[model samples]
Target: MVTNRLWRTLSAFNCSTRRWAPIPLRNTQSQVTQRLSPTSRKIDTLWTQRLSIISWNIDAFSSRPVSRAKLILSHILEGPKSPDILFLQEVTPDVRASLLDDARVRAAFLVTDAEDQTSFEDVPFATMTLLSSARFAFGLDSQKESDGIEGGENFMLGRISRVALPSKYRRDALYVDIIPPTAPGTFFRLINVHLDSLGDTLHYRTHQMEILANVLREPGCSGGVIAGDFNAISPEDDGLVNKNGLVDAWVALHGGADPDGATWGVGVERRNGLGPGRLDKIAMMGLKAKEMEVLRPGPIEVPRPGEEPVEIPWSDHCGLRCTFTI
Candidate 1:
C-alpha cells in the first residue's frame, strides 16, 4: 500500500524532460503507412494495425559486458523481423555506448538517453527505449498546426519523459509519447520500467506500479504500454496488472500464465537456488495484444583472457516480443 509519505516523495521527483532527441541519420527506408487511421473504411480494420514491441533485461552485472551486449544487439537488430519499439533494462554505460555506436541501430531507431548524459546517475544500470525512426518521422509530419498549440505543449515529434520512482535502488520509469500516424492529434505512451528487486520489496513495487498506472490514466493520454523487469518473485506480484487496470500481454494472448512463458532463472544459474519465474512482462491499456512470444537468443561463446572460450547466455533473463493493435 502506498502511504502519504510515498506520494509526497514521488511528487518531488516527478520532473520531466525531452529525452527523445533524434540521431542525425538519413531516412533511407520506406515510409511507414498510417496504422491507426481514425477515418478507416471499416471500424474492424482499426483493430488490425499491428505494432510490435520487445522488452528485455540485459543483465548489466554479468561478466563480459561487451560481448553480451553485442550478442544481444545482433539478435534484436539482425533478426528476421525487427520490432517497432524496444525496451531494455539493466543497461550499463558500456552497453549503452555499444547500442548508440551501432550503425544498424542508428539507421533504424530514435533512441532515448544519449551516451553523454547519465540518465540514472545514482544507479549502475538504466532503462533505454528505441522507437522506429520512420514511424517517428511520419508522426511528426502528420501533426496538425493546431495540435502543437494545445495546452501550450508541442505534440510535434512527440516527447520522452522520465519519472523517478520512490525506491532505494534509484529505479525510474521512462515514458515516450508516440503519435499515431493517422491520428493527427492523438498519441499513446510507451513506458520502460525496472521495478524494485528482491522478495522483501513488494510494497515498493506495488507503490511504483500505482504511480505508473496513474501516469497511464492521466488526461490526454489515449493509452499506454508498460514493459520491463518487474522482479516478480512472490505471489502478490501476479495481481498487479488487474489491480492497476492494465492487461498482461502474455496472459491476454494465451488465456492464462503459461509455464513456458517464464523469462528468468532458466538461462543462467542463480546463487540463491531459486527456479525460473516470469520476472519480465508487457502490460498495456487501450491496446489489443495480437501475439506474444519469448525471445531466447541462447548463448554465445566468449573467449577468456588466457583460456578456451566458454558458452553463456547473453543475459540471465530472456526477452519478450509482442504485437499490439491500437
Candidate 2:
C-alpha cells in the first residue's frame, strides 16, 4: 500500500528520539497506519450497515412547558449522530408540534393518555407526522391482552386501541421499531418503559417485569434492545432481574459497578442513597453494544445577559444512552 502525503506529514510531527530512545516519526505512522487501516475499514462498513437504538425519559410535558421533550431530544443529539431507534418515556401529546417541526429528523413517536379510551390519544389537534415517504410502516403498540405474558394481558404502547393489560396501571409504555432505509427489511425492536413508581402500593412493577421478560423471549424479537427508566436498581443489586442472556450495555462497557459514584441525594422526601438506586438503565438482548454511557450534564439554565445558563426545571432525571450495532 502506498502511503499518502498526509501520512508522511503526520509521520514527521510524530517522529521523535527516545531520552533513552526517541521513537521515529516514520515508525509511528507506519505502526498506526498498519494497525488502523483495517480497523477503519471495518468501522466504515459497520456504520453503513447497522441500526442503533436509544432509550430516554424526558421527564413529563409539564416539566418544561416551552419544550420539555424537545429539550431532551436536543440533549440526545448532543454527540455526533442521533439514535435511529429512540425509546422515549413520558412523551405527552401536549407538545408534539414542536418536536415534528424539524424536517431533518425522521421521527416516529407515539403518545397515550389515560383519560382517552381510544387506540390513540384524543388530541385531534395534534399533527400526524410523515417520518418517511418510503415503504416504511408505523403503528402504535397499545397495551393489550393478546400481547401480554401468559399470566397477564397483552400490553401495548402508544395511542392505539389495542388489547389491554389486566393491570390497572395508569400509564402505558411505548415502543418503536425502525427499518433502516439503507438496509431494507433489516431492523431492530426498541422497547421503552417507565415501571411503577417505588412509592406505589400495587404489584404493577412485578407484573411489568414479567411482561417485559416475556416480550424478549418471544420469537421474531431479535436484533433488538429494551431500555428506559427501569425505576429499579441494577440487576446486580436485584435478583428479580436476571441478566441471564441479555447484556447491560452500560455495565458491559463501564464494568458491572457503580459507573457514576454520585449519590441519588434525597429529593422531595426519598433517601435511597448511593447503594441501591439507579432508576435509569439501558439493556440489550441481541444487537451488540458499541458504546454506552449515562449523560448527566450540570444544570443548564436559560442564558442571561453575559451570564451562563443553568439546568432547566424541566426534568428531575438524567439521560442514559447506548450506541449499538445490529
Candidate 3:
C-alpha cells in the first residue's frame, strides 16, 4: 500500500511539471514574433536630425612662407558659426593639413586632383574641397573620373545611412546621398564647382555654366546645391544668369541684385578690395537659400603672431557663404 501511494504521488508531480513547463516560453513568444516581422523592424529603425549646411570658398592665392597660411587659417576658424559642410575653393593639398588640423575645425573630404596647393610653400591655385560633418561620409566619386574635366577626379562622399539620388539632370553631376540627423527620406546631394574665371572667354564661361546646369538636371541628383566662385559679376552679367531651375542665394538675400560680394574687383587689384571683376559667388539648386553672407577681410593675425592683426590681401577675392536649412 505504501509503494502504491508513492507511485501515485510521483505521477501527480509529473503532471504538475508538464502544466507549468510552457509558462516562460509563452511569455517570450510575443516578443520574438514582433522582432521577426519586417514591418515592425522597419518601424523600430531611428533616423538622424535635419541637416544645416555652411559653405565658403577661401581665397587660395595669398600664401607666402608664412602669411598666406595664417590668413587662410584665421578665416576658417573665425566663422560666425562652425560649418558642418565647408566647401572651400583655392585650397591646396599642402595647406589642407593646416585647415583640417586646426584645433577648431574637423576634416571630412579633401579631394585629390582638386587640391591645388599641397603645402604652405606651394603656389596657390584653385583647390576645391568639400567638407561634411563628422556624422556624414564623404569622398571622391572615382567611378565618374571619366566625366570630370581632363585630370579632374570625381570625388564623392555620403552619410553612413542609406539615401537615394533623384533622377532629373543628364550630365554626371557629383552624386552625394545625405541623411540628416533627424529626418528620414529627406536625403539630398551637393555639387562643388569653380566656373571659368572672368578671364576665360564668355563662350567658355557660358559653356561651363551650361554644363553645370545640365549636370544638376541629371537623374539621381534629387534636391542638391551647386556652390563656389562663379567669377561672374552678377547673373545678368552674362545671358546665362536667368533661373534655369536653381536659385541665386546672394541675389535673394540682398534684393534683386547687387555688386558681386567678392571684394576683389580685378585680378590685379586683389590686395585691398573687391577686384576689378566680381570673381566670387555662391549658387544653390533645388533648395531654398535661407541666409547668405560674404565673409569680408577682417583683422587676420599677420603671419607673425607678435605682429598686429592686419588685413590679408590674400587672394583676388573674398569668400561667399550660404547657409541652408535641410
lDDT of 1 by residue, 114-163 (tens): 63545756679888887665345423332333245333222234555666
Per-model lDDT: 0.71, 0.43, 0.43
TM-score of each: 0.79, 0.57, 0.57
| Global lDDT of model 2 | 0.43
**What C-alpha lDDT does candidate 1 achieve relative to the native structure?**
0.71
Candidate 2: tens digits of C-alpha lDDT, residues 90-118: 55555443443432332222222222223
- Quote the positional error of residue 288 for candidate 3 in Å: 1.0
Candidate 3, 284-308: lDDT as tens digits: 5655677776665443434567776
lDDT of 3 at 159: 28
lDDT for 25 in candidate 2 is 16
1 or 3, greater by TM-score:
1
Worst 10 residues of 3 by lDDT: 1-10
**TM-score of decoy 1:** 0.79
Lowest summed-lDDT stretch of 10 residues in model 2?
A: 1-10
